[model samples]
Target: MAVQWVLVCHGLVTLLVVVSFLCGQWPIFQGTFIERIHFFLTSGAYDYFLRFVGAVFGSKCSNAVLSVEYYCCDRPNPILQIFYLGILSMTYYFIVKSSFAYIPGYYLSGIHRYTSLLAVAVGILLFLLTSFSDPGTINSANVSQYLSAYPYDNIIYAEKECSTCKIQKPARSKHCSICDRCVARFDHHCGWMNNCIGERNTRYFMAFLLWHFLLCLYGTVAIGLVLAGRLKELRVVYILTVYYGIENSFLGLAPHVAQWLLGSYNTLILIAVFLAIVGMLLAGFFGYHAKLCLTNTTTNETFKWQEYMSWQRKLNEAKASAAALRASISGMSSDRKPLLSKWRAFFQRSPLQDGQIVQNNVYDKGFVHNVVEVIYPLSSRPSFTRPKLKPT
Candidate 1:
């Protein structure tokens, strides 16, 4: 019940954030009560943004200056509202993850299992779709129109000279404030992205987006449920005055969230999709990370470790500390050496490897090495038989 409660809450928060983001991007509610409210708050500086979004959406909104033809729903054919609404993510993460989690203990850890991975993946995909897909490119409004409308349009690509960057600029592409370059698949000026979106970690970066988004959406859903339950426990709206005995009162902890996002299938399905997709994306990302760790391939050195420095660093680190101690005392620093050089040395000199010396000065005597195969190394070692005396 506790776990179930948690999942429910997460779904709510997930739905709201996605809805709000989509609303800003697509303004589906134009001419509706909510749309009027948005128009009022965003009409001044945000007029152009509002209009471009409006044009893409075929809704009525004012115009602005300087624009780029990004943020189009350039999905294959008719892009459904469900995609932007994040309904896809909700289903996968919630149903799939909850099912997987209920199956006894995590085979490894609470989160390292399939359930968690699935949850994370859904989050990643939605983020990619939103972050990678350009509003301008996908929108039909010509670049000139977008340019005239978007006041800050000059910064779109910053007069970039790159072949890979979008012609009208990708959704999150920015003229790297520092790199003096346009990041192809930029998310943010995140203190990290390793090296601009080249061949290696574009996938991993996408994975990162998926997992992080999942984490957020999952939290939203979990919290939303809790808030909802609280709300139902207390009647709301018109009943508020009667229930509270106040003329016009607010501030009951029943859960405003439930009122905002509940009792609609389109919404319910959207939330479910967000959860489900997030779960799968997470699973895939972590599995990839695990494989990379086991195989010793890093994000930077994805396909190959071309740099001599990386190879040297890896070789130096690979030698067990025992080898380090031996080398340090013997005045032989293994730094900057090739991997094979040290690999051959370990088998030749180390008693631990040959089965003669079990544990000694080479490594701290108490150290535990070859623990599983310790018996083999000891028994196969030369026997300590009392030598037969020679009869001279």
Candidate 2:
């Protein structure tokens, strides 16, 4: 009972962490406690703790002791990177160790084990690539070039200089306060990677996500197969067979079978449950990134777009109210029109309809083009030169 309680608590904590990570990415939670918790976790406390342990043990550590203030400020720190890598490695180790030993011999005969190993290998490779890859940093040398990449649409993007970088802000570029640098087509700073995910590294990040999703999915399925094999071997289903005046219902036997399965394959069942939950979460993340790729937008841009829409809505409402007031004071017959009619007029004349509120997304060429751009970044494509920006 104690062990069961411990496992339950562990699983709940894992679930909560995963949910909090997802919510942290959402713009709605920007000022919420979820964001604060996310900030705290991503901060460099782990790094400091490790250094302290190392110092106490008289270990020779090369890295300087990072200030707590700097850590809390969200600067690039590798503390969480080790934690992430350790968790992934531990998960892979358990899956390989447990699945090979406990699963029935017949189920492990084919290329199933080889396929799972291959997925893990590929996932690790992608993870390394994403962590090390450059995320299109904007330096003084390439600032002008980046600026000419996309024309300013004047709504979400405008011609201005970054106060910190003191360089002209590119159309899609953003200054990352965490990294203390400007990034081209900046998406968001991913603490898991211990790096930014911008134009150059976004593709690698997405591929990493895909590969990780596959790894989790493969692990879960393999464990589930092992559980099924154990069930078949035990014939727990047949043992619970009921033969009486009452019909033999599988429903009646299900609870007993489940209890037997849980007791028999406890460890495998726990691993499978954890992998399945994490797999579903990864799938959600993958789908979101896929949508962003299709729309030719970044996480940063998506939040900005949401804010712009909200402001536009408010402006439209204000305009409608003013128009109604004017019509009333003038004693115009149009004042008698339905509220729907007034809203329609507002919509027709609103800045949104007139292309003032929502500007043309200069970077969005087409679906195929956008996908290609992400996969083969402009920085790598030497033959492609950005067109000159037209005067606004």
Candidate 3:
């Protein structure tokens, strides 16, 4: 019973940490403990650690830690890439060590041993493709091509030059300070891949996300089948029903079966739980990126649009306030009239109600076109080099 409780608690904590880390900043989670946990996991914990180091050691040691952090986070370093590989290898190693002997058991086929390796290899290939591929870097020679491909919308994107690169910046291109280069159709830089996700390699990055999700799902289901096989081979369920006199019905037998599995295969349960949580997270992340691709938007564009909408809303409110004041003054200066009834005043619409702001995304060329654009970036097409001809 104690062991079962411990496993339950461990699963709950893992789920909570994963959820908080991934979604603490979301509007739905705002002002919740999940948000606080997210803050601690992402930044607060590191801050406290740094303070502890500074207090315990000297300033020189603290400076070294800060320098390591700067290189790992603010600059283009392979720390996360190496970390990702390490985790992947270690997880596979554990799975093989704990579960491989039962691979050809009753519920699972022998072929899974090879298939699992292939799946992981494919996932790593996708990762390498995303990590090493050019993310549509805009350089001096091809700047004209990029400019022709993406015209300035004059709203979020305006006709401007990149001060750092000294080149005309195309629409949707952003200068990545970490990479120290301008990327066309820029998405956020992924620390895991240690590369910017941009026009050229967005497809690869998306594939990496989707494939890894499937891989985790595969592991979870495979491990579950292995555990189920163990139960069958050991006759644990039948023995419980026969010798222990437990009821055969699911509700009656569930607790006993659970306790048996918890006692016998706790490691497998942990691995399955971990994989399930990670799979769900990857699925959600992939869904979000898929939505962005369908809508012809980037993570950076989302922030830009939010800022634009906020500014527009504030401007509209200011104008409404001025209009209301002017109307009040004009009414006061005019010949006196009967004041409106309280009921009439109560039902009257406020001028500020007109302050609703809508986002206008010119680059969203419709669903199919948007998806195609991501799959085959405009700059990759030959027609991208051709500038629009002026009217005769």
The TM-score values for the models, in the order shown, are 0.23, 0.77, 0.95
Candidate 3 clashing pairs, residues 3+ apart or interchain: none
Q: What is the per-residue lDDT of model 3 for residues 1-392, given as tens digits with 9 covering 90 to 100?
A: 89889999999998999999989999999999999999999999999999999999978889999999889889999989999999899999989988999989999999999999999999999999999999999999899888877888888999998999999999999999999999999999999999999999999999999999999999999999999899899998899989989889999988988898898889989999999999999999999999999999999999999999888888888899889889889998999889899999999987777556778888899999999998888877878776667899
Tens-place lDDT digits, model 1, residues 52-98: 77678555323222222122211122234345335545544464444
Worst 10 residues of 2 by lDDT: 58-67
Which candidate, 1 or 3, would have the higher TM-score against the true structure? 3
List, residue by residue over 176-270, the lDDT tens digit for candidate 2.
88888999989999888888999899999999988788778878877877777766666656656643232347777666666666655667767
Local lDDT at 307 for model 1: 52
What local lDDT does model 3 show for residue 120?
96
The model with the greatest TM-score is 3
- Against the true structure, what is every candidate's RMSD? 26.9, 7.0, 1.9
Error of 1 at 85 (Å): 22
TM-score pick, better of 1 and 2: 2
- Better candidate number, 1 or 3, judged by lDDT: 3
